[model samples]
Target chain A: MAKTLTIAPVSRLEGHAKVTINLDDAGNVADTFVNIVELRGFEKFCQGRPVEEMPRIVTSICGVCPWSHHLASAKAADGVFGVTPTPTGRKLRELCNSVAYTEEHILHFFFLAGADFVLGPGADYKTRNVIGVAAAVPEIGKKVVHNRHLGARILNIVSGKSIHPVTAVPGGFSKPLTDHERDMALKMASEILEFAKFSIAWAKESVFPKYLDAVKTVGVIKTGYMGTVRPDGTMDLYDGKIRLMKPDGSFVDFDDTKYADYISEKVLPWSYLKFPYAKSWNEGFDMDLDHPKGVYRTNTLARLNVCDKLSTPMAQKEFEAFRQAFGRPCHLTLLYHWARLVELLYNAEYAVQLLKDPEITGRETRVAVKPRAGRGVGHVEAPRGTLIHDYETDDKGLVTNANLIVGTTHNNAPINMAVKQAAKLLIKGGKYDEALLNTVEMAIRAYDPCFSCATHNLDGRLAVRIDIHRPDGAVETMAN
Target chain B: MTERSPIGLAVTSVHRDPAEERPEPEDFLDKEVLVIGCGNVMIGDDGLGPAFIKHLEARGGAPAHVGLLDAGTGVRTVLFGMVLAEKRPKRIVIVDAVDMGRAPGEVFEIDLAEVPPLKADDFSMHQLPTSNLLRELRDQCGVEVRVVAVQVAWLPDELRGGLSDSVAASLERARELVERLY
Candidate 1:
């Protein structure tokens, strides 16, 4: 086929995405792009509400990892309120955060990523997902389900609800946990440790090393990475100073107060979602497509790049080992999901320790919140990556405006460019098999974009779009 | 001493936030009657559950002694509330304002069997809550739970000002049902 093949609005995941494979006249590959098709005006929605209610309002953004946004928005609100929680408050926030990471990351790895590897890339797309894995490896499949259920249950215990929680508010939790709740959660999380360990090896040994040579040449976009920097200078998921590092692994001071300084976002004519790039350009496509310049990456890969250690022993060891092979800073996106598992493992381990600690039962249950009207910013790392809730408001606490940079926002440019790159690679075949398509799907998943979490509202007009360029002219195609 | 915990007389009539914003689980710990008012009280009728919780809270004079939990908007907290009960109750009266095509504030104490598990869950901090959790416990531990809800005039989002006079009057019926349940 002389024309580019496009499948817009990829089905079944979340939100909108269209996959396009560019083809030349001789039917050779040109480029591939998986265009994201949603925009979150959550930032605007958050403006003007009494800053006190910001946490609750923003927590509704994503059902998968509410704690991330809840904490991020709360911290931002804390910034506006000029109030930071006592150390205990920070710990509680971290506890809430750890539970979220364990649940969300586990689900993504096993349910989302498991299909491609266990089911085999060549398997039928329909049968190559969770269902296929369940049929092929019943025990491991059951274990994943069992562990996932336990993780969800733990979230239920800690925050009251598993999916979209409201437990970790601005000042502190509204209720104190009893010893029984703590004991039960600790026991359940401990059981999940074995399952999580099994999953990481499944990635590192079974998946990563096997596919290493293949993916090493793929997803080679080099851009600056961004994530929250801890006080200890390690990667922090719940709360920390924001760190923007160069592609060469050189790090600068981490600062949350000056977020607008290092990072930036751009909207492509092809995708509704905004692409976040480095304010300073290092390499890749001209970020300003019209003029094209900057290229920076954020989220999990960025977190991994910016961190030297994982807080948990097992994950930290794996981190050091992976870092050794991939070099000081890893550029491959295939390693992205694997890094997520590493984070998930540590989160599980940390959750067990925190729940086992007796002091948790006696932790101060609430923070006396004095909402003397001001703006606030909340920052927490979501499962996919770092999330920010920036709000500006008047003293009446009525929000003037709200801007949210979600897990996927940070990868907007790279994700789209990846699709284009892959399309350019696979454009030759007029007829494509499921395996090739799955590879295309995996390319998008590398970024782990949560489209549903980003797009708010029921405007059903959604599609995945790709632009195909021939030597003579360019054409656009779409699907829903 | 009694067959079931008499939760009604021990209730405090405090209206819960319609959004169920509390971080705690449902008053599942209470295990008797949970008066969940699904409205923002500052705006008016959403104050239904908290108003009742305050009444119940006042009854025992303290929250710890009186299991009158203000579930706020947290539906998931329902389990923790039920589990908190040493011995589950026979009937659980939930006083949330429902627009069931009835007179505003006309409180109805429908038996658990009669409420047909409309299964429409509270979107608070809970997921697949109420009936599902109750079933899990009953299947695992054999605890039977019930609910009592009142009909309101305005919609949940439409309850802008306060409870309609009719819904406000329903509080009396809810308060009365609490008296009878205990």
Candidate 2:
């Protein structure tokens, strides 16, 4: 007999998710599924619209990561129009991406996941939130809040609005960076760089060390990894070739447009989100912890694992130490936090470097782009993972077809695998408590998957309900 | 090097050639009162916030002291900016839609004390956890927060834009209530 235990509306990480774990006759873990609600035909509705509108329209796809969608769609449109942005245009876009990443990563590390590490996983539910984090670690909390604000301000200066940005257009950015704006941006970038320095040092000294034991034991799995990198194998977030790396640190690089040939989506019966697997592996999709196939992770750890080196000096040093401590292709699930900090430092340094470039303040930011019929693919390493936007346009420049594989979508299978792995280790013989449940969630949190972006259509009514179904298929209890 | 302003301290506003170019970060911070309409214009009935704000703006606009923002599900970021800003609005009036089993188009106020606990904690305009930001503004930052919610005729099943007739009809009244708040 198999009993089912369901945890609905998994909390805190953006959007909604439900975890269903099955228990065998002896109360041992049997299987698990993470059900996500799919967005209501956003890509379908995108068809027939003027392709130029994509960069603007896609911003609404997810309020949380609009900058990623905006820039990715703009680049795809650039591909469709067969035009390259001027040096300033490309640099501005990259700068915005870096700033946005800094904001998102800080938000996640301090406010969202911070509650777990700062306050302890077993802390009272009421006090285990952003406000709680602020109350407990007031100084760090202020730093997080202030730095995030600075990131937002930088974005506002670069783009028009920090949330639904309109600055990135098909050919390039709409506005030119004036001398005054350049000076302001560089100053902010330098300050952010300092904070980035402090953040990585703080995390290493105070946070990662305490979690080493949990990192080794919780939700650890061996899977392939994916990220974007320059031709020289340096980590890149804005634009680069896609690298698909195996568990052993070996990888293959492919053009961004060839993603369809390497990846295929698997539709599971219970979940609305599709499981993206590496079709290139020739090993069909499977989520078995012991013998998973075609499964891979994206986001921070994946980017760190797939890249040969970091571009910035400080981040390169940090990366070296990380590799020294944990061999290449680190299997520790919790190391994502450590990897995220390193990337944060890189973005900070990279942003300052870009701003300091003479060409970054050039008056010509865009090239004239004519509407043409063509297929185009664009990708960016969104703070979460690799985000790909593919589009086909008609001779009249109307969008004939549109497809988006957001960063979170690529990790759908891996997230479920990680969840199951953690549940098996923590929920032994169906013994579980709130604290233990949170520890299990910590595994999912490490990946920082955005269910909202993965499956954009949520009904807005999210309440966490736990349902325990007995072996006889009768629900023994339901708690909300 | 340009002087980098300290956290939670007022910074000098950047001057621009076009006087009416989109407001800068300083403008967002300097508002004495903010009336932000929070909702998704893509879902039926959920577009109440934008609809109400639009009606109000069309009716001879708010005073300079009152910054009327069409947040459009991006309230979280706006509120986050405000939370970290050196200056903040003394009052923030949020117009939104809620389905609490009330009559269609029925408008009501959700008291600060009535906000449910932060489950997801991530705040948004069209989502439940949005109340967390309002609470934070009220309790932590000392910004007076008020939510005016219209009983929605169920949000559309698909991504159909525009408001339901009932929700649309109630926009005027909702606008009036919000105007009174400011």
Candidate 3:
């Protein structure tokens, strides 16, 4: 007899998702499925709209990481017009990206996944939230709130509005930073840098040490990795060549626009999100733990594994330490949290370095764009993962076709594999509790999965609902 | 003699630089009442809150001391900042659309205590965990909070913009209720 065990609305992820595990007559884990509800027909609606408005229009796709879509769309629109942003324009955009990264990483570490490591996974549900974290760790809570607020403030100053930015235009940024604005940004960046330093140290000293056992055992999988790197293979979040590294530590690099040549989307009947695999691998997609094919990951740990070095000095040091400790191509899923902290530090240092550059305030922020028919593809290392935006324009510059592969969508296959691994490792003999299920969720949150941008909705509902089905096809049990 | 001041309303976007040393913009910190339109205008009836705010601004008869903001979907950012800054308005009113199994286009006020617990903890900052934030603001921070909710007519499953006719029609009624509350 085959039984189906379901975990719907995987809690703490950005949007709704479900994980279904199959069991054989012996009640052992056989297979797993992750179903994410995707926003319907967004690209179809984008057709016929003027390509220039894409930055503004795409913000509504996901309220969580609107900046990612806004910037990526703007970059695509820039490619369409064949105009490069002025140096100042590019710096401002990168600055915002860094600030946004700090804000997001802090939120995830402290409020979302923080509860798991800070208070332990078995803590009562009521005390395992942002409010509870604050109560338990008031000192760190205060610092986290203040620094996160500072990040938001920096974004507000640079982009006019942080949530749905309209500053990035077709050719370049819309506004140039004044000397005063630059000075203010530097002050904020300095404070943010302090917090970023404090964060990584705090994680290493307190959080990561406690989770070492879990890191070694939970959701460990060997797969290829992907991220953006410069010519020298330094990590970049804004613009760079795409690098897809195999599990064996060998890799290939290609131009950003040539992603289609290397990647392909595979659709499953139960999931709304598409599974993107490395087409260049020549192997078909499979999530088999021992003999996986065409499976790779994106996001923090993946970026760390794929890049040769981080551009900033402090972050580079941290990366080296991480490498020496874990070895390259680290398979531990829980180490994603540690990798995220390293990136946070890199973003802060990078922002400060950019702000100090005198050219960041130059007047030539934008280049005039003349529209014509062409195709453009833009990619960015969004905090979640690699986000790509592809657009086509007609003779009049109206969008003819649009396609977006957000960060979470790229990890669809890997998430399913991780969830399956965790379930098999923990739920022996089909006996499990809420804490056991949460350990499975920890596997998903390690990716800091942001489905709000990958899919779409606004109902304030929790992700991760569970339903256990017996071999007889009857629903057996349900839990939060 | 006629009044010297012109009859007009001022509308402002919420994005601001914290470094600017500007005064309290006519008691923004101590206002007796603050009205916020909280919804994503891109969806159908969810635009009611912002629509009602627009209607009120066009009508222009609320008390001079009261401040109105189109917080849109980023209401959490504003509310969270206020919590940290300790500069909350005395009374906060949130206008939004909800489907409570009520008639379409119907406008009503929900007691803060009666508001149900939000479905899950918020995973994104674009939306605050509203029920929790509201309670925190009222109970912990000692501020008065109220909700002005309109029953939504439709929210498309796809990326469609603008409000439906029935929901748009309720704008006037919502404005009237806002005026009475002020």
Which candidate has the top score in TM-score? 2
lDDT of 3: 0.78
Proportion of true contacts reproduced by candidate 3: 0.08
Backbone clashes in each candidate structure, one number apiece?
A: 83, 1, 7
List the candidates' TM-scores in order.
0.71, 0.90, 0.88
Best by lDDT: 2
Q: Candidate 1 DockQ category?
A: incorrect
Go through the candidates in order and give each one's C-alpha lDDT. Answer: 0.61, 0.79, 0.78
Error of 3 at B72 (Å): 4.0
Q: Total backbone clashes of model 1?
A: 83
Query: Which pairs of residues have clashing backbones in candidate 3?
Result: A8-A464, A8-A465, A9-A463, A9-A464, A9-A465, A10-A463, A10-A464
Ranking by lDDT: 2, 3, 1
Q: Write the per-residue lDDT of candidate 3 for residues B40-147, one digit (tens) a residue.
A: 766677767777778888887468778887666556555654554435688888888887878998989998665544311321241233336676677867888878
The fnat of each candidate, in order, is: 0.02, 0.12, 0.08
Q: What's the TM for model 2?
A: 0.90
Instruction: Encode model 1's per-residue lDDT on A134-230: one tens digit a residue.
Output: 6787776667656765766777676676544566555656445566677677788888887778888877777676677547755566666777767
Model 3, residue A477: displacement in angstroms? 15
Top-scoring candidate (DockQ): 2
Candidate 3 is scored at a TM of: 0.88
